[model samples]
Target: MLDPISILNLIDDVMYFPILIIVMAIAGLYFTFKTRGVQIRLFGESLRILLEPPDKEGAVSSLQAMLVSTASRVGTGNIIGVSTAICLGGPGACFWMWLMCIIGASSAFIESTLAQIYKQKDHKGHAYGGPAYYIEHGLSKPKLAVLFCIFLILTYAVGFNMLCSFNLQSTFIDYSFYNPTTTPVIIGAILAILTGYCLLGGGKRIIKITSTVVPFMGISYVIIALIVIIFNIYYVPSMFELILKDAFDFTSIFGGLAGSCMVYGIKRGLFSNEAGVGSAPNASASANVSHPAKQGLVQTLSVYIDTLLLCTATALMCLSTGIPITPAVSGAPYVQNAIGSVFGPIGPIFITVAMVLFAFTTLIGNLYYVDNALIFLNGKTKPSEKFMRIFHVCCAFIVFIGATISMDAAWAMADITMGGMTLINLPVCMLLGKIAIDCLKDYEKQRKMGQEPVFKAESIGFEKGELDFWD
Candidate 1:
């Protein structure tokens, strides 16, 4: 009989490969066509809106919201996950990852646009919404909305956060002082304590931290990647050739279809960018933009930043080093070795610090989404302060448990929950995508007329009181 971990992996493969992959591809294509490829046509607008100030001083701005979502999107999946994909699936996986990001960005635009359309404001005038809010109001499926929130909590808080903790601790294995038994325990305790401190400070703290850390870590990592690439400049052309050749190797793709480059690429790409996975929409919905589509457009840029920039940086950094990418060197070790090949001991140390920053921000950014879900679950009101405190403690405990658990278990759990969220969110986005497209058209019309795009629910046929914010 297969062991529990093996079984979990099997289920994850079955869930993603033919089922979720097909659904995601179709949804991505559908949205791209329906929105007339808004992700591409309005790419400049996304950048423009990123600098626009929020209507109120205290509200979340477009840039801050994108950073929050980017915090969750650009985590261990960019480094460890990309290394694993290249090792298991070959350099061709990078090609598929790039393809998925370009296509999947359209889906990101749709879901986040819908989120802004259906967002609700708290008593403090803070805006919040997500897949659940849109499903409830736009689709009028309250039960299904609640179910989506349940899945969000499971996926973000329990599954993804655990995986982050585990990935962070796994980096310590390379150090001479690392004791498998004690190191994980020590790392877990420290991570949990830091996470608790941030979580207790609430949403603003999460946003503040992510906004500060994400830019610095992202820029620093990219700079390191550029240096690695520059050092291996002679191999750059051949590396590109290898990636393209492997990507289209029909025999390899069919022979081991489940383990092919396409499968791992799409899987890791989805996990990394979260373009259609419904997670980023929670952060996207929080932005106080003049038009719903402004935040949506801003979010599309985030997908590129995560996959096209960050994930690609990691993939090329590893592939250019000419390292043997066997399964044994699949995750952090491969990245460490690749960077170490260029910069020696300091390379591994830098990656460890990168992983720490990546995973820590991901933990808190993920909890921000969990906080939104918890409020929705509690009748769209804030949970009791005591209950929230208890919840944060439990979250910290899960982070601790995650660090000590088997990596296979951590990944499998995250994949399953993430897959569930994608399956639920994608179909719903397709069904309600027309509203988002209409919103986009309105925004475009205003822009063409040299006026700022302002959204009113009635412009898209939504009635008075149909939406909490726009109406």
Candidate 2:
């Protein structure tokens, strides 16, 4: 008989393999072709628009919105998750992860573009939208939108937050004073309290916090990774060869597709960058941009930063160290040890500090998405302030519970819920993809005409009343 954890893993596998993988690959390729490779072609434009100030003084800037999404994307998954992928899937996992990001960036463009096109305004005149908003407003499918919201809330607020909590606490396991039974509880409580205080301050607080913390931690971690790589520069060529060799190892792929590097690579990539998983679109929608495609392009850049830059840093730091990739040292321990070997005692301490910042920002950023989901679930009305307070407390409690759970169970729950979100979001994005493509065309036409691109719903055959913002 299968236990609960086994059942969860089984469901995750069934969801991801064959069905999820095929859908994601097809959708990514389809969008890449349809957009004429927007992720690549508009790369420079994304950078330019990223620096544009918000039209209004207090509104969220494109860079701020990207940072919010980046805070979520560049968390434990970049470090511990990358380590786990290498340990379980071999050096080849890095190759697949890079490939996945390239393909998935197109999907990110479509979904985030759709979010901007279909975004709604709250009573306070703040923009808020995501997969649920676009699904309802763009597709005119209210029921399906609510379903997406439920799945999103479950995935981000509960499952992913739990995994973040577990990953953070796991870092303390190697310390001399660490106690398995008592340490987790104490750490969980402290984390929960800190998170609860932040959550009560609302979305602006999340934006402020992420925009400040993400850049510092991300740049610092990448710099350290570069130092480690430089110290082991001789191993670079062989590392590349191993990655390529393992990525296409047809023998092992045919033997057990589930255990292959491709599977783990894609899983970790999806979990880390969240390009098409529909989470980033919530942040993308909040950006006060002149054209929807601008935010879309910025988000595409975000995927590259998350997977190509940060995750690659973690992978090379570990693999280039010539450390043995084994199941026993998978996840956080592997990363800590890899760094510890390079910098001695200071290495592990740096990792622990990095994880704390990464995981804490992730917790708040994930809740930011949940705020959008909850708003949509409440019939496009913001939930009462009292209700929000209660929800925040409940979320903090979930974090505590997550910290005390087994790693397997936490990850299993996250994978299944995340898969559920992807299954709904991808097909919906495919249906509404044409609008985003047209928006891109309109933006480019204006750009070529030497004019700043500003969106108007009527210009794209969307009736004035059809949209909440652009109209």
- Identify the candidate with maximal lDDT: 1
Error of 2 at 56 (Å): 2.9
Point out where model 2 deviates above 4 Å: 201-214
Clashing pairs in 1: none
**Model 2: which residue pairs collide?**
none
lDDT by residue (60-138, candidate 1, tens digit) is 9999999888877889999999998898988899999999999999999999999999988887888989999999988
Residue 469, candidate 1: Cα error in Å is 1.0
- My TM-score estimates for the predictions, one after another, are 0.96, 0.96
TM-score: model 2 vs. ground truth:
0.96
| Each candidate's clash count | 0, 0
Alpha-carbon shift of residue 295 in model 2 (angstroms)? 0.9
Please write out the lDDT profile of model 2 over residues 1-471, one tens digit for every residue: 999888888887788787888999999999999999999989999999999999788999999999888878889999988988888878888998999899999999999999999888877788888888888878889999888889999998999999999999999988998998999999999999988988887456665765586678779999999999999999999988888988889899768887678888999999999878999999988999889999999999999999999999999988888988898888889998888888998999999989988898889878878887887778667799999999999999999999999987888788889998999999999998999999999999999999999998877789768899876
State in Å the error of residue 142, model 2: 0.5
In angstroms, what RMSD does candidate 1 have relative to the true structure? Answer: 2.0
RMSD of 2: 2.0
